[model samples]
Target: MRSETTPARPLGLTFRLDEVPAEGRRFEGALTEQSLGADLPGMVGDLGYRPTGPARIAGNVYRSAKTELVVDGRVTVGVGFDCVRCLADRVLAVDIREDHVLVRRKARVVEEGEESQTIDDEALEEPDVETFSGEEIDLTDLFRQDLLLALPMNPSCDDVGADDCRDLVGERAPDEPQIDPRWAPLLEMKKKMT
Candidate 1:
């Protein structure tokens, strides 16, 4: 009987950042027990099994006239992913400490010889890149992207198959011959000539 225990689920909280309107307002909370939705599931494709883990997200948000939301903080996340090489389910972790600025709508200003541009304005209209919901920001997509970014395109988990895998990538094995599809017509012509 194999019994596995996943980490405790964190709590979920939701609040509007804009609700507390201030030049420099700071909001912080702990995600103790939470559940990730089916859309942004776990590392494994299996829908029946849920990817459970503990995460701590702390950030300071400042709302400026020009900037709707400016968040700066570190999101520590630990997750489990399948090893590409051995196909073994392994525990992988990532810490994303990033600063993101979201503008709801750019303030229009009159300037000499300046055509009103909507560059930053466009980004403001869009959803929050780091955290979408006003209250609790789900770290599922962010966590998954970070895990894949940390992984190599082809990771070698063993030394025995390292050479073989490298050779396969370089295509230098003697047993393996490179076949050119363009020569099919030439081979047919040569057969008729013979």
Candidate 2:
């Protein structure tokens, strides 16, 4: 007699539903920068944040329903970017918590007399929901999106007193008179009135 078994998955952020146990499956792995492939580069380019090193992901996938899987995880990554103020290269370590629901796509069969229904606007706004047709659940995209969103919008070198930053400050010497040319006439009138 042959027993049914779940297919084995290589180490990474992908899991097959059949492999997940009734109690849930826990996974831990590190994804190198090279392993992330081309999509990562494009996403980094668009977001202006570059990955400085590999990312570590640890998570649990639970069978919430017969056709749904719930994924909860934490991601730790190092990101690099040019400082918005100083223009110096800055690196930041980011940690993000991810939670999502993956649902199996149901085949739609419309009868000749049956009318098709469209999804409502409220359904469109649900951020944690995703649909998959195959038995495999790939969490790579979800993890990447979470990491990108967790990055700071304006990264800074945090060295405002440095020489490079001082050059950009545009401060004049204490003895120098700082005045706008347009206000010269007003200054002259005030001096005459005094």
Candidate 3:
């Protein structure tokens, strides 16, 4: 399972920085989970989200002023995850359009007596802006960012109607309240006061 915080290396969704024409070009393809791995679903099983099908990607890349790459695209896929109510597997169909403003990464310059690294934000107000370095621009990265955003923080059968949610209707916890040993004194004090 892949950790949510660490990003896997590029899985071959790259385009040359100098190759994009001013007129812009369209790129489209279907990305299989095998290619994107845990990022798409099965690989991120630890995150409780998985892809049930291939992710379709279609987009346009254009080289703009300041040598920035702008991406406009759409992705459609099904995500499989355990429902919060019953632990039953459920699938959520996802289709979303995303636009990314990508800028080439500036080389970090460490000066004398510098205790921290401060970034220059050229497009600080632009939503969904990203940065890359070198001659290659990886679209796979864009796919990863967008898909991660699409996942619901809490998925339940009731949310998507994936199931009837009847499984938890009559379930009940043990009559005894669960308590932590460290909190016994505090809890006892409160009970005495009551």
lDDT of 3 by residue, 49-91 (tens): 6767688888787778655888888888887776655667778
Off by over 4 Å in 1: 1-25, 29-34, 37-52, 106-121, 124-194
- The numbered model that scores best in lDDT is 3
- Evaluate all candidate structures by whole-model CA lDDT and list the values in order: 0.42, 0.63, 0.65
For residues 76-156, could you state the per-residue lDDT of candidate 1 as single tens digits? 555443333344444434466655654443355859789877556456455344324334343334433333333222223
Query: How many steric clashes between backbone atoms does each model show?
Result: 8, 0, 4
Give the better candidate number (2 or 3) by TM-score. Answer: 2
Clashing pairs in 3: 38-43, 38-44, 41-50, 41-51
Ordered from best to worst TM-score, the candidate numbers read 2, 3, 1
TM-scores, one per candidate: 0.44, 0.66, 0.63
Q: Between prediction 1 and prediction 3, which has the larger lDDT?
A: 3
TM-score of 2: 0.66
Q: Give lDDT: candidate 1, residue 6.
A: 55
